[model samples]
Target: MSVTSTLGNALSGLTAASKAASVVSSNIANATTEGYGVRQVQTTSVSLNGQGSGVQVVSVSRNVNEGVLADRRAADAAYAQAATLASFYGSVEGAIGLPGDEGSLSSEFSQFEAALVEAGSRPDSDARLANVVRAAESLAGTLNDLSADIQSERLEAEKEIARQVDNLNTSLAQIQDLNGDIRLQIAAGNDPLGLMDQRQVLIDQIATIVPVSVVDRDFGQVALITESGGVLLDGTAAEISFRDVGLITPDMTVASGGLYQVEINGSPVDSTSPNNPLKGGSLDALFEIRDELAVSAQGDVDAVARDLIERFQNSAIDPTLSAGEPGLFTDAGALVDPANEVGLAGRIELNARVDPAKGGEVWRVRTGLGATSPGDPGAGGIILALSDALSEPKVVASGSFSSIPRTAAALASDLLSTIGAARQASENEVSYTAAKWETLRSLELEGGVDTDAELQKLLMIETAYAANARVIQTVDEMLDLLLRI
Candidate 1:
């Protein structure tokens, strides 16, 4: 080969080695960077008249463990879902309080029962009668507070859904923009590895919100589809939409249009069903809290309210309370409309005739709710009957509990037990999902860019560079000898 061709070959090798060195240096620098892909410089041999002339630096390619990455993303979604549910259950269980705890639902019921017995023993004591009224009010007020807490959770979930939808849209749009930018870089023969890394970050963000699957497309672009076959992006990003219902109530529901639904390209997607498009993520968990979990909680508490209302409203228990008339407890100060039992827990209140704060007499506790006057202040008949009604075992009229007879306090205990069971189950799931996520995450990191490996690659690149430089130096010396001759 001519000395000039030899020089040209050395120059090509120098260029290839320099590019390889740059790639290795970048890998080392970004070793701990999240979502940064390890890169390698690609090369091909140049040909002249079917003979190798030199080396050509082709493209820089990224080394990504696609399988591990996919598994990690799925684990991310599962962990998000489990964590959200566990948090919600923990909140509810905390609000209800443990058995025998002060201010707990069971404690309030027990206090009311105990107060009733005290007043029945001293029926003439106005203070004891007032204590009985106050205890009853406390029990009703506790139910109201619990119902309100559940609705608050529903409202929070509603707002969160809206926020998540907006974020999902923003992320999808950003991904689409990155996709286009990556394609442009590829077309211009520029390295798109950096843009691809950024795209992966955005996709990981989206994965926690909703599970997605990536699909390879031409021109270095990618498409995303939900696990349940909902197209999130093809060539263009799908517009995810949700309407913000600023206020929510127990009566409000998505089915009745009181709550909004999540939409994809203007098509409704059920957030609660097993076939939900965006399942196994935080967004789905929020929907479950709003539409299913909170609603169920409200149902259980309202059942307790219904039992309390009916227990005292019986003519046999309180003969003075006329048919369809409220007893010791009233629904918003009136008789309960069975059709409107959805929010009864929040609306339940101590009957006005016995609530001194409402211009009623405290002696009404020993008399009757419908009694016109304090006929006999020392009459303990009515007070003892009221106490019996509270303590007697009776079948509940509503909720998922068995129809077997239970005292009012026992029903209260059952509510706590039910919510506690759910909370424990959810906590268990959180533990399981968190472990799975961590294991997958550790596996992915184990396969990630290794600084030591990158340094070794750097050493190889340096050797190749030195060899190329030596060849050029030899060629320069040979050319000088030729020129001198």
Candidate 2:
């Protein structure tokens, strides 16, 4: 090669190496930055007629995997949903109390059992019967209040999810717009690094709601897509919109799928199945809360109530008289059906506390049944039979007050077991969700920087830069000598 040509080649090499060093420095500077990817300056040989000329920087490329990145985004959305749902359920578990605690349902039922036994000792006494009635009402009230509170919390979560969805859609649209600007600039061969950085930050934010995949297009353009292969952004932008939707009815049930559907440019999309990769965000969490935890919890409450009502009514004591001789007591009434009441969800009230002070009256408990007194003599057989019924296995399911004399304690034990089972199910859900969250977090960090590795690359770049500087210095000295000759 001629001297001039050789100098030109050296200059080009120096420029290319300088650009490489700058890229390495940029990587090292952002080593700890979240969502920052390593940048590389691609170079190509400038050749003519099979003759080497010099090197030229082709383009700047970011280190990222479109498929893996999309997966991470989807995982992020699911993790957020699970995390939110778990947190809310955990709160419910706290309110209900843990296993073996006095604050638990089991402990409360034990208190109810004790009151029943006390009343059985003086079945003829109005005061004792009143106490029994009151205790039953209190227990029912507690269950009603707790169930109502759970439903309230679920409503709040639903609203929060709807708000978040709107915010997420706004962000997605913004990203699409940025994509358009980036493509336009790159098509004209302009450096859009700043815009690209902003877009990457937005993608990271999107990942927090749902996972996404980024496809590098020509120049500095990027196409954003969902893990499900839905085109979130191509050359143009699209709008995502959300609406406040209902999921559960007053009867405590999941509404139809249409209740929580999402829309894009007026077309509906399913957001239930995670595998189908619905829009990633807190919406997923709300859906699970409404459909899974809330529904199951309601079922558990109904089961407990049903068991109590059935058992108590079956074993309840009913006094009989000879030719209607004023009855054994004025309040010798049968249990009321709980299911007829708004709160019991079709359960029956077996033992309601009667207030004897307000005249011999039947107490109202669990929507129907209350304490009763037979004003006449010879009501012993009826009371005894009732007591025997309570002694059977189904009092927790039956609501029978008759077996209070012998089986009170056993019934209380069963109540405890049922409550424990419900709480355990809630805890299990929380545990599983935590594990899923950790896995997603690890995936997020996979494409993120390793500071140690980046620092090593920085060192190598620094050494090359120094060597290139020395070469330039030597070349300058040689040029000076030749001039002198």
Candidate 3:
């Protein structure tokens, strides 16, 4: 080979080796960086007049297993959904109070029952009557607090949905901008590796909010579509919209137009629908809490409140009650309108006629709710009657609780049991999804930049650099000898 040809070849070799070393070092540095892909330097032999001349550095490319990454993103979304559901169920269970827990529904009922017995034995004792009244208030307070808590969770879920919607819109817009940048870079023959890495990070974030599938586009751009075939982004980002109701009540629901559902590209879609495009992510889970889980819990509590109200209102148990009068438990100070009993739990309170705190006499517990004056001192029929009514098995109303006849105490216990079972099931799902996410993540990492492999490539690059240097040195020595001769 001519000296000039040898010199050109060695120079190209050195340049290629330097590029390779740079790529290898980058891989090592970003091994643990989230969303960073392994890089490789592409090269090809240069030919002039059909003769091999030298080498040329073509381009740098990133290496990532798209299939594994997609699967990992899916698992991550599933884990997020399961964790959200588990949190809702756990919160409800805590509010309802587990069995044997103080201030729990069952405990409150037990205390009320015991107080009723004590008051009945000493109906003339003002202290005993007052104790009975306080016990009833405690029971009512428990239900009131529980109902309020459920509504609070629902409101929080609504707020979270709004936040996620805003976040999703912002991310989609950013991705669109990145797509334009990537397309321009690719067209200009630039690397665009860093922009691609940033895009991948944004895509992964979108996946956690709503599981999506990426579609490759012209000029290295991408389009995001949800698993249910909703196009979140193509050339432009689809605007996601939601209205936070601010304050959710037990009676407010999507069906009643009280809660606003999610909208996509200006088209309203029910977020709680089974066929929602953005299912299997935290967004969907939030809707489940706002529209389904909390509503059902409130219904259960309302049913218990209805049971309490009707039992005391029954003329068979309390003849003092008129045909339309409230019993020991009133719904917001009036007779419970069975037709409008959605938030009865929050409204259920101790009958004001029997509570001095509400400007009623405690003696009313021993006397009658409608009595004009104090009844006979030995008269404890009202207390015993209310007590017996609570313990008696009866069919409940208004809620999805079992249709079978059950006592008030049994109904409360069943509500707790149902919540506990659901919580357990959701936790099990969380465990499964979490394990799956970890496994898929590990598989993804296994395909990421391996330090050992990068180091080995570095050694090869060093060898190539040394060989190219030796070639140049040899050429220099040959020229020097020729000049000396």
Candidate 4:
């Protein structure tokens, strides 16, 4: 090869080597960075007169597995959702007073059962009857508190969903802007590597909120699409909007698009319904908590309440005490003669209690009386049923209103078991998913990072640079010899 070509090749080698080193340094620096992926330098050989001159950097690329990234994101959503639901269930556990001694739903119901035995001994004794009533009241209060707690979690989940959607929109917009910048840089023949990395980071983040896919285009531009076929970015971002109506109460709607939206330039795009790839994220989890679990709890509450009211009133003394039998006392014992036996019906109330400060307590029974005077037999039975319902093993069917306490207790046990099982499943999932993530990370390293390879490249570049320096030295020596001769 000609000396000039050799010199040129050596110079190219030095430049390429410098660029590669810079990329390597960047990778090492960001190795521990969250959401940062390793980077690679692409090199091509230059030929002079059909002989290899030296290598030149073609481009800088990211070391990423797009499919793995998508999978991780989906997993992230599921983890978030499970975590969210678990947290709410924890609240429910506290509100329902699980794994405790006193005032717990199970314990309270047991106390009510004990009180009933005491009441049966001397049904005529006012003190024993009052004790029974108070126990029933406590049970009702617990139920009320539990129901409230579950409802509160549902509402909070709704709010969180709204917030996440808004944040997603912001992230997506930033990605579009970055894409534009990258395209411009690439078109100008500049290395858009840094910008690409930043955009990739953003995409990874977006995946944690929803599922996503990327389509590469010329000029370093990439299109962002949701798994649901919604275009998040095409030249510019696409617009996405969420329904304002809530999963629970239609009237109790949260703000729209607060969690996430895709905007393409200025136009909006609708994400695919069930086909939407955006599944794993905190937003998805919150939706599950708000819709499925909370709704189930609400239905249970309604069922228990409706059944209790319907059963006792039919057979128990009516809310209105007659001329012979006096109506039950209110807060005080002063009683007016019942206008009719139906007075007992109004006296019954579902009494439950819960910790207002905590998140998860719901479905405790409280005062059975709606508007009737207190201490009537029917009202008393309603109160007793509320107390014992948590421990009983079977559902209190509509036909057997008096058997509510036993039914409720059985149902409560079943509910608790269901939650326990769900929590266990979540724990197993987290472990398995974490292991899978590690496996993917290992696969990435196969072609991702190798110190030995980098060192080999370094040595090759150094040899070329040294050979060129030697040529210059030889040229100087020959000129000296010519002068001396």
Q: Which candidate leads in TM-score? A: 3
**Model 3 per-residue lDDT tens digits across residues 267-378:** 8886756778988899999998988888888999999999988888887777777887888889988998989898999999998888887799988888878887887999
The lDDT per prediction is 0.90, 0.58, 0.90, 0.57
Give the TM-score comparing model 2 with the true structure, all chains together. 0.72
Write model 1 residue lDDT over 129-180, tens digit each, in one string.
9999999999999999999999999998888889889999999999999999
Error of 1 at 290 (Å): 1.3
TM-score of each: 0.96, 0.72, 0.98, 0.73
- For model 3 the local lDDT of residue 65 reads 96
Ranking by TM-score: 3, 1, 4, 2
In model 2, which regions exceed 4 Å deviation?
Answer: 1-3, 47-53, 81-85, 88-92, 122-134, 193-201, 204-240, 245-249, 252-261, 267-282, 306-316, 319-391, 395-456, 478-485
Runs of candidate 4 with Cα error greater than 4 angstroms are 1-3, 35-37, 48-55, 99-101, 122-128, 242-280, 314-406, 445-447, 451-464, 483-485
Clashing pairs in 1: none
Which prediction has more favorable lDDT, 3 or 4? 3
Residue range 1-485, candidate 2, lDDT tens digits: 66556666777877887787788778778767766666878989998668888788998887765565565566566657656765666656654554467555555566566665665555566565566566655556556555665676667767876776676677777777777778788778876665767777787776666566777776566676777767766766556665655544436433543345556667666655655454555666676675566655655554555555544443234322222222211212333334532234223333323343444353222112222434443233444444444455543333322333324335444433444555566457556655766675576676666667767866776776676567667778888999999
- lDDT string for model 4 (143-162, tens) is 65666676677768767766
Sequence-dependent TM-score of model 4: 0.73
